[model samples]
Each structure stands twice: as C-alpha cells, then as structure tokens.
Target chain A: MTDAASLSAPEAARRSLVGWLLVLSLPLLMAVMELSVYAVEPRVLSLRNIVNVLDQASYAFVFASAQMMVILTRGFDLSLGTSVSTVSVASALAMTGLVAAGAPDALVVAAGLIAGLGVGALVGLFNGGFVAGLGINPFVVTLGSLNICLGLSTTISGGGPVFNVPDVFSRLFYNGKLMPGVSIPIMIAVLIGLGLYFLLNHTTFGRSLYIIGNNPRAARVAGLPSRRYLMFAYLACSLLAAFGGLMLTARTGSGEPNLGGSLMLESIAAAVIGGVSLQGGVGGVGAVVFGALFVTMLSNSMDLLEVGGYVQQILLGCVIIIAIFLDRLRQTRA
Target chain B: MTHIVDRRGAGAVSQRALRGYARVGFLPTVLIVLVVAMALFVPRFLSVQNVFNVLRSSSYLVILSAGQMLVLIVGGFDLSVGAVVPLASVVSAMTMVWAGGAVPGQTGLIIALGVLAGLGSGLLVGLLNGLCVAFLKVSAFIVTLGSMSIATGMALLLTNGIPVYGMPKAFVSGFGRGLWFQLPTAVYLAALVVAAVWFIQNFTKMGRYLYAIGGNLHAATVSGVRTKTYLVLAYAVCSILAAVTGLALTAEIGSGQAVINGQLTLESIAAAVIAGVSLKGGVGRVEMVTLAALFLLILTNAMDLLRIDPRIQTIFLGLIVVLAVAIEEMGKRRTPVD
Candidate 1:
C-alpha cells in the first residue's frame, strides 16, 4: 500500500487535483444535461423533478456502492440484480406471512428486513465460497448464482408480485422524511455512502481488499487473510443490494419477483462511469454517488424529452461503452 | 509432454489412458447414465417420438453451443448472443414482410433479402463487439454486456414490443419445419453447423491460432499470430451462428419476437462448459458440446415427463452448471503439469 504521505508534495497535489476532477465530472455532466434539457423542456428543471431524480438516484447509489465493493476486490457479481429480486420476494413473503399471522407491525418489518438481509448474506456466501474459497471464476459462480436466485425468487413468489404488506411499513421506511424534502431512502443512501467511505479508507479489512485486488499473489505472500476479506466484500455487496431492494419493496408495497429489471447492468454502468476501474483496486464512494446521480439524471432527462423506453435503453448501452472506452483511453494515457 | 513420453511403460500407459478417458468421457458418461435412468424410470422416455422431440429442441442449442465453443476457444464468452437471436429474427422477419409487400410476389427474392438483412444486422453487431474488445482493449464481458443491451433495445424498437408476423409460408415451412428424412429441418441445420465448426476447429490454421491465443495470448502474439484479427473473426463467427439460429427459430415459431430465446446465451455457454470447454479458454470438443446439449434437452424433457415443476427444473439447471464447473476445477487441481 502506497500512502499519500510518502509521495512528494507536487505529486500529492496533482493526485488530489485528478481526484477532484473525477468527482466533479458527473455534476458537470449533470449541469450540462440541465442546460440542454432546459433549452428543450424547461419544466423538467423544477425542484419537484429534481427531487424525483434524486429519489430515484438513491437506489442506484446503493446498488452502485454494492457493485463497487466487489469490483474493488477484482470480482464481478452478476447475481446482484437477481439477489435483489430474491430479497424482495423473500422479505415480502416473510412480511406478508407474518401479517397474516397477526404479528405486530414492527415485528413484521423487522423479520422481513432480517429475512431479506439473510437471503443476501446467503447469496454472498455462495458466491464467495466458490470464488474465494474454491478458486472458481467469479463470473461463472455469480452467473450460476444469478440463475439460482432468479429461480428461487420466481418459485417463492409463484411467478407473481407478492403484495399486501402493512401500510405502516412503507410509511415509516420509504415515505417518511427526516426533514422536509428529505426522504428515508435518500437518508439511507447518504448514510450508507458515508459508512462505506469511512470503512474503505480507514479500516484494515477495506485496505486489505485493495491490496488483494492489486496483487493477490503479493497479498497472500504477505499473509493477509485475502479469502476472508474477499468473502466479506461479496457479503457487503449483496447486503447493500438487499437493502436497496428492501427500500424498493417498501416504496412499491409489494415483493416483486421481477424487481431488478436492467439494474445489474445499470449498477455496473454507474460504477464504471464513476471512475471505478473494472480491473479493480481503484474508485471510491464519491465516484459512486456521482455516477449514480448521473445515470438517474440522464434517464430522467430522457424521460422528460419523451424518448421511448427502448431508445433510452439503447442510449444507456451506448453510454456504458463510451464510458469504458474513455476509461481505457485514460488508462493508456496515464 | 515429457511426462507422457516418460510414462511409456505398460502400467503407466494404462493409467494415463484411464485418466484420459475420465477427462474426455465425463459428459458422455453422465449423458449415458441420464438416458438410462430416464428410460428405466420414465414412461415413454424411450419412445422414438420423444427422442426426436428432444433432438429437435436441442438442435438450436447445439448450433448455438458450437459457436459459443469457438468464442470460448478464442478466450472470450459472449453474453450478447441471446440478444442477437431476437434481433436477427425481427430484422429478418420484418425484411421479408417489407420486401414481399414491395415486390408483390417474388417469394424467393424476398426470403433472400430477409436472410441477408438479418445476417447483416448480426454482422454489424459482431463487428461492433469485435472492434471494441479487440482494438479498444475493453473487457469482453463488459463489451458483450453493453452490446446485449443495445441489440435487445434494437429488437424491441423495431417491433415496438410486438412479434413480427407475416413471414412467407414457404419460408417457414421449407426451412423451418421441412424434414429431409425423419429428423426436423433444424436437426439437419444443426448437424451442418456442427460439421462446419468441427472442420474449423480441427483442420484450419485459424482454429490452431485461436487455441494458441487462448492458451497464452502473449506467447501467441510473440509467435506472430494476428491475435486481433482472429479475435474479431471468432466473435463475428459466433454472432453469425447465433443469427442463423435466430432465423431458424423464427421460421419454426412463424413469428419474430423480441423476447424469444432469452436463455440461449447462458444455456449455450452451459452446454459448452459442461462438455469440457474451459471458461479459461483453449479447450473443448464439438462432439462433446453437441452431446452436452442433447443431455440437457433430455434432462428437461424427462423432467417434464415426470411432471416436475418448471421452477425446480430451472434450479436443477443452475446446480448442474455450477457442479460441472466445480468438478472441472477439482479435476484440474488434481492433475499435475505435463
């Protein structure tokens, strides 16, 4: 691990400058989007729409952060979207089952939350056990787990939406606000971002992940518990995904088997666009926030422009490619 | 290489032969066991009609897996193949309809135009994927993932989320459902593709180059192999085969739908890997992949016969994929370097 203090003053300053630029790029892009959309449709610039974009971006923020953790350890979790679906379905079923059994609202919510998080943790264990413990490729393991989760979700939900949660659940979790104009989801996203930032930058486990991702051979030679750290990374990733799914379940007031439509790709797109390298050992919470915001704003702006869903999807695909291309260019130049 | 030569003694040779059999016969052995068990337990499992049904359904998978094997051999796997299927189907179907309407009776010309358009669309996507992955140095996974989204969007946009109907009756019947012998037309098509792929893998310089590239890319580059061009070719061929499967499937179903064959990409990869195609690349056999496809189809067919829940079947499929890969990993660990 190269510490910032070891670098010369100019080098440190230049690095910080680059970091600031990367962090600023998304807001800069969002500003440009605002200007362009204003020229086309001025109504989209209203505070209500801005808040709507932020609210939607909250989900992306959480999902992107989850993806970032695994990518930091040089792993890909293709199962994230399906895991979210499973969590949604599992938690929803648990809650609904509890509700039918005459459980109190708080107990129902707590059990549902625990069930969702538990499913997420189990998926993480499955993936981590294969990839970290058994030395299988993360791609194949996660792909297998994706299918398993999809199947499990559909089976548990009976291939339909699980509905009829207690009204109070959504009221306190998703709809409630900490202050005026600040929804619970937005607050949760912010808290998660801060927690992840602190953990990644200040903790031994987080620092060890970076080291392992940078050079697994070296990390192993240095006697770091690389496998355990990798396992925790995947666990954290899936837990965050489950948390996002729980928020979504609250908002929708249902457990949706198909809840994760296109989110797996979008989460990766968000992280990648936020300067998170797929090769790993780089990126941060700031990048993830900006990336999530940018993706949300782009979609929101396109929606305001009345672009069709299919066309928006096409544009998003293009965005992913272009982001990766630019990242490659940056890598080569650096 | 030296180990095999040094182990020329009678006992050593038999041991080596047994190990080789275990390596090469894993899929076939499982397939045989599955067939025997299904036949013994399931009613009508051994019926000729059921066997043909399995073969007919597996023909498309076999074709797709043949292409997937090539890409895997060349050190990349495509997630976009599934999207390419629907995109090709929609484009081809729409082209045939439009051309038929314009010409007012030229069936042959219309079919030609439709096939060309569908293949052209596939080629374009393949080119995009190849260019990005080979020239721009993007990860094949991300590139294909993006292309998958793009192709899917294009398919949906072209059809407005509706299935394209009105394909020529002759087009659907002659190529899609027509049987030369007792087998479905698709079975013949799949066989032809398998033969073509086998020829490419066994007899062509491109095949050897692909293996070399996959086995050790740096070594291949050092040895003057044109890695970039071959990589593009591999991807192009893979997508083109997927397009072929798409066209055939459209013919069979008599419509072009955006959502059709959504599972082909993963299933094809699964088939190839289960047949011993290494995800790490530079391995696999066409015959084995075909057998693996057949095995999967039979497994599904048998489960359906036994009235197993489709959801449980899906879970079984996932477990099989993971188990196959895990077994391969264990086998690799047990084997010493030659």
Candidate 2:
C-alpha cells in the first residue's frame, strides 16, 4: 500500500530545492548575459555594478515583497502603488515644508523616513479596518483604497510632482558604499530581504497568513485569529510599501504623483513570476526576491539591447504568462 | 378585526415581495435620480448634446458589462474582457489601416472584419478561461488573471505599443458621428444590445441553467445539466459581448488605444455589482446592469461638471461600488452548508 505521509517530507524538500534553484537561475543567467553583452566595459560586471542593480531593485523588492503577502492570502493590494506614491509625496512635503523648514539635511532625511512610516501605518489601518473589520471583499476594498490613496497624493502635490529636495538626503542613500564596492542601497536590500525571510519562515503570524489563505474557515475553526493575522499582514505590506516609497524619494530627490503608475501591476507580475501564487499560501520571500530580480534584469537587458520600449512590455507580459503557466502546471503535477 | 388582520398579513407578504423586487430594481431608480439630479444641478449636464455624448461614451462599457454579467450570473468571472477590448480595437484598427483595404463603399465588409476580429479574440480568450476553469479544475480567478496579462501582452506585441489608426472612416466615423432620431447611433446600438441581453437572461433556458449552476454547482451537476458545457457557453457569450463593446469603443474613439487604464475593469465590475449581481453568483438582471451603467455615467458626468478632481471622482466611484456590494451581501441570508 502507498503511504501518503511517507512521501510528504521528501516531496516538500524536493519542492523547496526546486523552488530555490528556479529562483536563482534567472538572475545568475542574467548576470552572465550582462557581463558578456557589455564585455567592452568588463568593469560593468564589477561589484559596483552589482550595487547599482541592487539599488535599482531595492524599491521594487520591498514593494513586491509586501504585495506577496496579499497574494499569499489569495488577495492583492493594487492600492499599494498608490500607497507608496502617497507616502513619498507626504514625506517630501514634510521634509521640504514643515520638518526641515530649511533645517540640516540629516534632519530632513530623518523626517522623511518617519513621515513615510506614519503614512504607511495609517493607510494600513484604513485598509485593515475595512477589509478585516467590515468583511468587504479584498479586491473591492483595495481598489477603493487605490483611488483614495491616489487622491491623497494629488491633494498633497496639487496633482504634480514635488521636486527639489535637499541633495544630502539623496547622498545618504544614493551615495556611500556599504563595503569597498557594494552600495548602501544594496546593503539595505540584503538586510530587508533577510528580515522578510525570517519573518515569513520563522514566525507564527507568517504561517497563519498561509493558513488563512488556503482555508480561512479552517483556520478560524482551528481557533486561529485569522482576522488579526490578516490585519497584521496588511500592516506589514503597507509598512514595506512605505519604505519603498521613501527609497524612491531618496533615489529621485523628488516625489511624483504618477511615479507609481506602472508599479502596481509590475510588482504583481514579479510576484507571480517568482512563484508567488495569486491564490495565495504557496510562495516564499526567496521566490518573490528572485522574481523581482528577474523582471528588473529583463527590463534592463531590453533597454541595453535598445529594444523598442513597447516590445519590452509585450515581452514582459509573455514572461508573466509563461511563469504563471509553469506555476499552474507544477501545482497540478505535485 | 380578524379580516383586517388577514388583510394586513397579506399586505406584509406583498410588501416583502416588493422589497425583494426593489433590491434588484434599486439601481435603475438611482440612475434616474442621478440623471434628474444632474439635470437640476448642472446646466449642461442635461442638455441634449451632452446626453448624446454621455450615451455614446457609455456604450462600450454598457455592452462590456452586459457580457460580463452573463459570466457572473453563471458563477464565473472574466478578467480578460478588458484585455480583449483593447486587443480587438488594435486588430480592427490595424486591419483597416495596415493589412487590407475594405473595398470602397463596402462598409459592411470593414464592419464585419472589425466585428470578426473582436469576436474571435474574445471567443478564444473566453474558451481558454472556460477550459482552464472547467476541465483542468483551475481556479477561475487565476485562469482569467493569467489570460488578462496574456491578452494584453498580445495586443502590445501586435501593435508594437503604437496606436493604430487610418481606418476607413465610413465604417467607424459615420455611425460614430451620426445620430438616429436625434441620438447617437452608438446609443441605439447599446440599447439594442441591452435589450437582447435582457431577453436572454430573463427568457432563455440557458439563463436558468446558469442561475442553477451558480446557486449550487454540485446540485446542477447531479441534475445532469452538462454544467461544464453550459459554463463554457456562458463565457463564450460574455466574450462575444465584450468584443462588440471593443469595436464600439474603437468606433467611438476612432482608433485603437492599447492602454486599458484599469478604469474599464473597475467600472464594468462596479456596474454589474451595483445592479445587484452577487459576486457569489446566481443573482442579478440585465436591465439592472444597464441602469447601473447609466447611473455611473450620470455620476461621472456630475463629478466632471462639479469640477471635482479626477482622483476624487475615481475614489467616489470605487466607494459607491464597495458600498453597493456590501449592502447586497448584507441583505443576503447565508445558505446552510451540507
């Protein structure tokens, strides 16, 4: 007789090994491709180049990771892009107008980060209150929040970008190598990635998100506070999204109303491609990180090759479809 | 006194029936209220010219929602409809502009090509969605979500991200610009589509089958309704409707716009939901959905006239959609599980 339990452990380990291999393979391939394609400037493959890629990817990484939470729960927060936009705009306004009032650069940077965090928490509270408290569908609630967040951002900037923040704020993030060659942004990405990995893999709350995603009633029946965990997940997503917003502001030295226009879908596509199931409860931090890396590399490569902008979008779309198709096939086979 | 009690009890039962009917019919009333209110508040909002423009503008969404309502009624959803809208638009535009000439004065030929392209794309996407959902036992949400990206990517790939134009003006422009009995022809077409949908939903055997499937899938299966086939047909019809909407939109806009703007997805679902279509499925009416579309048009028109910020307008619409759905869900009594 075949025993189901006997195969479970081996099957899970195999899945994990396969998942890790799949996640790392694309970025590794891209690294090789980048080195070869830009061989004339072989230094382009140096540690500094790695730092630049990380800097470019950190904001996407954070936002995509946060969105992975929602996707894990078999829901999504399209409003996240707008949340980042809103927080950045709010932070910019605070740093430029109230907190700094032309104060020192360090003070301005500190104020911006704080404001971003605060706005993120507030947005999370609103989302959680409606979704968890009122029992509204996650899609509808987040869709409403997307509009509301965009409106808030517009109200702050009068529907335009807030430009010309102090250069020192940028220098803190955009400048300074954490090591001999690796930049501060790369350091930040590594730290955040590790933090997320621990949170999702080690913590009870993280596991609860999976439980709730796969079977909410079952979780509830098991005496798990599904609502509370859901709320926490939204809070984490909001906080991370805000952090991404802050990084974006620092990188650009400005806050723009439409900066997040393409972000919502891109993060979603990245998460899905990275093996984060839209039905939720089946992906990991590592998978999403790889997904973001893959997408960023794809776009960067297309740009480097001077592929027309439109074709790149189509290509990205195809990649997303293929990834999801593969994911579905894997699920069915497993 | 006894007789009076009997009459009062009968009255209460009738009132209950009316209230149930009102739940389904409330959206039309709201649409009327919005129109009347706009007429009173905004001077230009009620003008014949503005009415025609709004109706023309709303035609594509109305048709799209009508198609989507069928799928929703049959216990399914189609995220690919918005993707198909733009995809079809591009194909139709490209066919007229790049591929071949619609023979001069053979206006029928151009329209037919455009319609065929639209329907074909919709049919293909819908069939894929149905097959995945039914045969493979894949979740409808995931299947449609994947298809959405796939269809959208196909459009961008096909057009290379540039808008296609230079269509034979006769096919798109004349109907797009001309009026029928003092209203845009598009408006009449929209009305015709809505009426047809109403007839199908209210009068057909397929409609009953859909409601049954939505109400209880297992029961429908047990009853030997060939549930999967009907489900596929439902999606096919929905996609065909979406195609019509796409073509109408292309005609209205006079070209293909590949960027979907995410608004159509929200608005189509919003219109269906506000019309009392339950997300859990097996409920709603075509007339109500048409009214829901008109209602949104009036609300949007009002906001524009009031000079409300575009972001605020979107928020307001989103809020209304959420509230409408929440109210519907709240009114419903939960069914007992087996």
Candidate 3:
C-alpha cells in the first residue's frame, strides 16, 4: 500500500479493476436489476420513484452503516433491532405525554431524541461492559439483550402500536423538507453516512477501530484504547439503531413494538453484501451506503416484478450466503 | 496453558478455587436461592401440579439445549434449530394426518413414518449446513444464519403460516395424556434423551474429537483428526436431536404450530451458557445443560406465579443468561490462561 505511488501503469489498472469489483459490483447489480424492472414498468425509473427508494433506504442506511463499523471490529449487535424497538416505544410514550400536556414542539422533539438515544446507550453499556470487561462472547451477551429489549418493548406497548403522537413529530422529523424537495430522513441518512466516513478516516478512535479490528494483540501492543473503542463501537451501533427506529416511528406516526423484526439480519446483509469483511478491518462507509441502497432497491424491484414475499425471503437468504462466499474467495486470494 | 493444568492441584488450592468457580458458576447458587425464594414468597410455587407443568413445558427447551451444546462443543452454531422445530413438527403433523388420519389398523406404521419424516427434514438441514460449513469452509455463524432464514421461509411457505391440525388421537393420548409414574410421557422421553446424549458425549470418540477441534482447530487437524467429517457428523447429530424434541413437543400439543418455539435458538444458546458451556466451545457437560433447563423452568414458573406477563419473563430469561455468563467469565479472567 505504501508503494502504491510507485506502481507501474498496468499494475495501477489492475488495482483499479480490483477496487471496482469489490466496491461497485453490488450497486451495478442493483442498477441492472432496476433496469430490468424498468423494462416491465417504465414508471419505476421516474424521479419520484428514485426518491421513494432513497426514503425507504434511509432507516436501514442508519442501521447498516453503524453495523458495518461494529462488524469491522469483529463484533455484532443482534440487540440493535430490539433496542430500536424499545427506544421507539419509550420515545413514543414520552412524546405522546408531552404533546397531550401541551408542551412546546421543541421540547417534545428534544425529549423524544433524549429518551430514545438514552435507552439505546444504556443497553449498549451493559452489552459492552460484559463483552469487553468480562471477556464473555459478544454474540451471547448481545443475543441475550436482544430478547430483553424485545420483551420490554412489547410489554410497554401492550403488544401493539403506541399512537396519538404529535403530528409535528412525524411531520417535521420524517417528512419535512430539508431543502426544497429533500426529505428530512434522507438528509439525516446522508449526513450520518458522511459523518461516519469522516470519523473512520480522520478520528483517532476510528483509526483504533481499524487497528484493533485487524489485530487485537497488535492494537494492545500499540497502546490503542481497544476495549474502550469496542465499547464505543457498540454504543454507536445502538445509538444509530435508535435513531433509525425514531425515523421509522415518525414515518408511520406511531411506535411499533414489532418494527424491524428482520432488521438485524438486514443490517448484516447490507454490510456483508457491501463487501465488508466479517473478519474485521476491511470496509468503508461509502461502500456501505451503496450496499444499503442496493438492498432497498432489490426489494423494490422484486415488488415491481410481483414476486411472492416468501420466495423473496428465500432469495434474500441466498444473497447473504453468496455475498459471504465471494468474501471468502477474496480472503483466500488476498 | 498445558503447564497450569498439569500443576492444577499441586500446592495451588487458591488457583483451584478459581477453577471451581469456572466449573460451578453462579447457576447452582442462583438455583438454590431462586428455589428458596420462590418456595417462601411465590404462592403455590411448590405445588405438585405446578412442578409438573414447569417440567412439561420446558421439556422441549432441555432437549433443544442439549443438542445445541453438542454443536457448540464442535465449534458451530445451529441457528436453524429455531426454524427446524416448526418445520419438523409441522411436516410430521401433516404426515400423521395424511397417513394415520384416524386409521385404526395402520396407525402404528403411519405414526412411525410421520416421526421419520420429521427427523428426515432435520437430517437434510444438518447435511446442507454441514456441507456448506465444513466442506465449503464458510463461517458457521453466517452459514447457520442463512440456513435459519431459508428454513424459516420454506416452513412458512409449506404451512402458509397456519398450524397443522388434527393429530391422531392415539398419538396424542400416548404422548400427552398418558402419564408414567405420575409424569407426562414427554418427561420420561426427555430423561431418556439426556441419558442418550450423555452416553454419546462422554463415551464416544466423536465426542472427544469435537472437543479437540473446538479447542484448537489447526492443532486438531495437524494431529490427524478428521475435523471435516466429525464436524458434519456432530451437526447431523445435533439437528437429529432437535428433531426428536420437536416431534415430541408437537405430539404433546396435539398439533403442529408453524411459528411454534420462535425463541428456541436463542433460548437454547442461553441455557447452555448458563449451564457453564463456553460460547467459544470445547467445554460443557450434558448434566449441566439438563440442570440449566430445570433452572430455567423454575425461574419462569416462579415468575408465572407472580402473575408476570409473558414478555417480562422474556426479560428475566435474558438477564439470567447475561448475568450467569458474566459470573463465569469474571472467574475465568481472574485465572491467567498462560
């Protein structure tokens, strides 16, 4: 990598080919899928349809971008989905009460973010505590918390959606225009993606993630704050997951305990299909943005083609498998 | 690491205490406290009927966890077991309806066929999982996750999200209604299974190989272990055991639910960990898993007596898993590995 500046022309071209193959394959495939769908329904390629795809991808974009970084550290957060559910329910309760009591709109929205992200952070704290400090497997720790969050969310909502939220909550948070035509959720997603890209590329904590991810012993030897960084990674994951959940709630104008049932898998699929190495230390946020977009686009295309939901699920599973299989091939060769 | 084990008890009584902590964890202590607390505080907690109820409902969990422990011991995770339970149960229930179908004379053969069909589905899953993981060298986590979704999709499609009803009267009566020694037949069957798994794990060469592989895969391979074959065999056995449990539970319910036991995979993983099974694999005992199953049932039973909602019980289960593993891990950290 340090010798890249001295590379010959043919070698540079080969490197470019490899880079495109790794980063652009999934998005190109998604484009092809969309083009095929466009053949059947030309409306699918319209400007309105493009925005809808972006909107649909936003919530998951938040989740996947966070998840990709955690995976880069060779850890997972199965509880992210359930944590999202829990926080959404908690935020809904806070928001609804505030609105009913005639609170100002600013206070209501502020309360929602605080309550939502608070619950997320607390869950992340315990998860990271046991996983990092006690040396327990992250999978087991997070898996247990996942169900805990699920139970709490359902119990709080009495196994239903919590409604009667202030119209302003959804109106401004989800559907409000950031620009003349851009949705708030899309803006948030883009900003978060860019924020993560800068963080991973420029920050000390972010560099620690790549180092600790690549080799834990080496990171320890280098005196990087590996454990602290791991804790922060999980914290960031849950925090972002809650933000996504809040967006989803605002989009529907209600808090749903059952929201994002498939989110853990979906987040993982997006990150993995985006060419993120599950072994840790090899991925970027830009690629993950494309990955999340590809997933949403694929789903939209399938819907346009009128595929059965069950078969689509089977296809989704196949894609995860194939994505990892390609990753293994790259791993062996690299 | 080997040196510490060799000098384990030689003037190392203090070190032995940490090892003891790793072995026992907080499970036995927590179980005793829970039992005492429930017995004193929770109403009707120790009633004979309630005891039976707890035992009956958790039979499936115990059986599933035992199978899962085997896979974990061999360095794999079988997330598909959650899907396998419903798929196995539904397929067999439908088979019973088609084959036995209130047929008096041919009930026995059809019932046998139905059980085989259920086991067959699990076996096929085991084979596919084993091939992709052991042969193709895909990580067990990703492979099982893929299988989890695929099997779940297939199950939902097969049953159309509805349960398979009308199990044979004779089968239900035999499995559920009739009690041997004042307990459901499922209890006795679960006991028989525990014994069988104990035998296989403690007495078989495959069991030894599984531990070897999990402890260090590269070293095991270098030492002439057939890691791939045993990996597949272990997964096959694990899936088959899960199938057996599913069959019994389906019969007990008198029908097969398409979404029955959605939490089985997580619950199984949790139970094994609470029972002192290392999530990294290579350590655990069948008896410990059995006890953990009972501990889980008692905890839930106590909570039920307090009129706790089902969802709250879910929280308690998760907390127990994390707390129990945390206790064990803290002990491990106190002891230096090398």
Per residue, candidate 1 scores C-alpha lDDT tens digits across A92-111 of 99999999999998899999
How well does candidate 3 score on lDDT at residue A54? 90
Worst 10-residue lDDT window, candidate 3 chain A: A1-10
lDDT for A325 (candidate 1): 77
lDDT (10s digit) by residue, model 2, range A1-334: 1112235776656666566545454565557767775765555456665656666777678888988987878778878888888988988887887544667777777887888899999888777777777777777778778877878888778888888766777777667545766667767778888988888778998878888887888899999988888888888889988888877888888887777887887788778777787666778877778788777866766666677766665566556655566666656545
Candidate lDDT (C-alpha), each: 0.87, 0.76, 0.82
> Which sections of candidate 3 miss by over 4 Å?
A1-25, A38-43, B1-22, B40-43, B101-104, B335-338
Task: Sort candidate 2 into its docking category.
Answer: acceptable
The alpha-carbon lDDT assigned to residue B231 of candidate 1 equals 94
The CA lDDT at A136 in model 3 is 76
Q: Write the per-residue lDDT of candidate 3 for residues B50-98, one digit (tens) a residue.
A: 9788888788888989989988987788888888888788889888888
- Candidate 1 vs candidate 3, DockQ winner: 1
Candidate 2: list runs displaced more than 4 Å.
A1-52, B1-11, B14-18, B74-76, B98-102, B128-165, B212-232, B259-262, B333-338
Single out the weakest 10-residue window by summed lDDT for candidate 1 chain B.
B1-10
| lDDT for predicted candidate 3 compared with the true structure | 0.82
Best-to-worst TM-score order: 1, 3, 2
lDDT of 1: 0.87
